[model samples]
Target: MQKTEKPFVEVNNLYKVYDGFSSVLDNVSLEIARGEIACIFGPNGCGKTTLLKIIAGIDKDYQGKVLIGGKSPIEVRTGIVPQDYDMTLLPWRNTVDNITLPLEVNGYSRRVLREIVVEFLKKMGIKLPLLSPVYKLSGGQKQLTVIARTLINKPEFLVMDEPFASLDSSHFFQIADVLKRIWNLTEVSTVLVTHDLVTAVLLSDQIFLFSPKPGRIVHCEKISLPEPRSVSDPLFVETVNYLQGVFLMGGE
Candidate 1:
């Protein structure tokens, strides 16, 4: 018999209330295996972001338990990529500067930072204008910079909330490709929050669908489609459609 591995992340009976009265999350519970990617999918205002925050150890005022690697979130190394890149990246900083921001405070020399960013980007098969101000980069480039910065620390877990929310189809797929490559290389346990079902199916090993306000996981679907998934593939289309139907039914 094979030994069972413990979950890398665990959220049990989670609950979040604001102002001590407004409930946002209700009895939420989940478990993620090491190196697996999990996505929280739901309609807007369904407390998806709130859940991500809890897991990321940003919002700690909630009730219940969330553990990463058998440790509290604050005790774990975490990287966060928020939905808003425009606000996250400093406009005055260049690409390389932005990518190395997370580790700069450690007193590393500029040459070391540049070399680190260059080597990391090379490994990820990503290319960017090292000296170009982030404000001048495209939407995809900005998001890429943010992701690079987040991963520079090589945290135990990656948390992203709607990272591609603002991109067009072209940029959306581009960013998705980059993210897939990164995950394949790092196999880092991740929790991503998104309203896009296609993204959830394409990027995650499992998708957790949440109900409306006072969110709860109504369904958990495992995605078995092979990599390089397409929106037009029959099975891919079927899975997306099935999830859509599930959502519709939940709404009804």
Candidate 2:
């Protein structure tokens, strides 16, 4: 077979099994191009989140290769915003501190870290008041803060697992637009794992539908819808219905 160009992120012959119960991901493989937004969709217990964890380097016990920019996921400069925002944020630190923590840990100078964190805060519509004591903020605010934190590093690749799960419909769309703008501005390759088919359709250049049990990719659909897609548009509706049908068939 002819080889494709090197992908920004590539998973080859991956397998993940816990305690020999069963393989969560069985010989799965995928490739994502630079600056491309790829969403992985699957039913619960289908190992979608597990696959994200493997790509994020949080779970390293899996077999096979996961490459980010031709390097292992742990060795690559990448950022992750998990589905559980609480896990990504430090409860002791305020929002600003939490957002800057990654930069600080990476040894960025104080001035540069502050500037970058502040800019991301503004981009995410996160005001200073919400920056202090993360427990005081609302769910949506916390989620936005997590996103700001993830982007502060200016990473080459971003891994997001249902980053908008807590937001209301209005905030969800607003944040979605912000994420798109940020991705375009930074040219970051993004992998977003979400159960919301509409959000996945709107944000991704390609969508990978996963099989139910083994969580292997069943379909990879290229989205040709025009940018700044209106959710109400007929084309958007048709695409969503088609993907939804695929998901239903997969038992999601």
Candidate 3:
């Protein structure tokens, strides 16, 4: 972003250490412009999720400044979708009930909450057995249910940690499409952490590439390819290849 344009989410000079040993994230700094979709891609244990935890207010035992829309994450409206979305669902609660828990607690009449949830699901084209217990649903369905639950509150921003990690290649693309759909429709600023370079290339407006453990930003580049990206598209392939090189260099 330009000097005059302020970021909606900003992290500056972050440092994190676990068990008072070595650093997890060292001197990490990055920014996300409002409504931009940025991806943080790196190898496992590179402090990707650790960085997100700090930004989400889930882990404050760190040294850094994490600001969301000029306020700390605790002071702003944000939702997190972890990789273990299936585990996050209420096993005893049926699909609809689990997704609507937030609304239910807010005192929306049962009838009203049901109507609202149905409408939201319809918009997303997600059709699941309303009364089916979450454990009975398929993996993809569970992920969808988690996304629905997260969206029910209509967060201004979203932080996703390898949300598609559990899926196979086919499911990966399927969920990736679902994510892109919501992203374009809602225009919500999102920070997605993923290990898949292809997924990042296809989805990100820009990418914040990290080095190995004790992670730090090694490359932050704007993805100039147009959307509705296809694997066969030359620009898409070129961009992916370019990012592959970036990642390779970062690991060296």
TM-score to true structure, per model: 0.96, 0.91, 0.95
User: What is the TM-score of candidate 3?
Assistant: 0.95
User: Candidate 2, clashing residue pairs?
Assistant: none
Q: How far in Å is the alpha carbon of 71 misplaced in model 2?
A: 0.6
Candidates 1 and 2 compared by lDDT, better number: 1
The reply for model 2, stretches above 4 Å from the true place, is 1-4, 106-112, 120-131
Question: lDDT rank, highest first?
Answer: 1, 3, 2
Summarize candidate 1's per-residue lDDT along 20-84 as a digit string, tens digits. Answer: 99999999999888999999999999999999989998998888989999999988889999999
Sum up the clashes in candidate 1: 0
Error of 1 at 91 (Å): 1.8
User: Against the true structure, what is every candidate's RMSD?
Assistant: 1.7, 2.4, 1.5
Candidate 3 lDDT, 174-220, residue by residue in tens: 78888888987888899999998888888899898899998989999
Cα lDDT of model 2 by residue, 21-72, tens digit: 7889988899889889999987778899999988888888999999989988
- The candidate 2 region of ten consecutive residues with least summed lDDT is 123-132
Full-model lDDT, candidate 1: 0.91
Clashing pairs in 1: none
Candidate 3 stretches with Cα past 4 Å from truth are: none
lDDT of each: 0.91, 0.84, 0.87
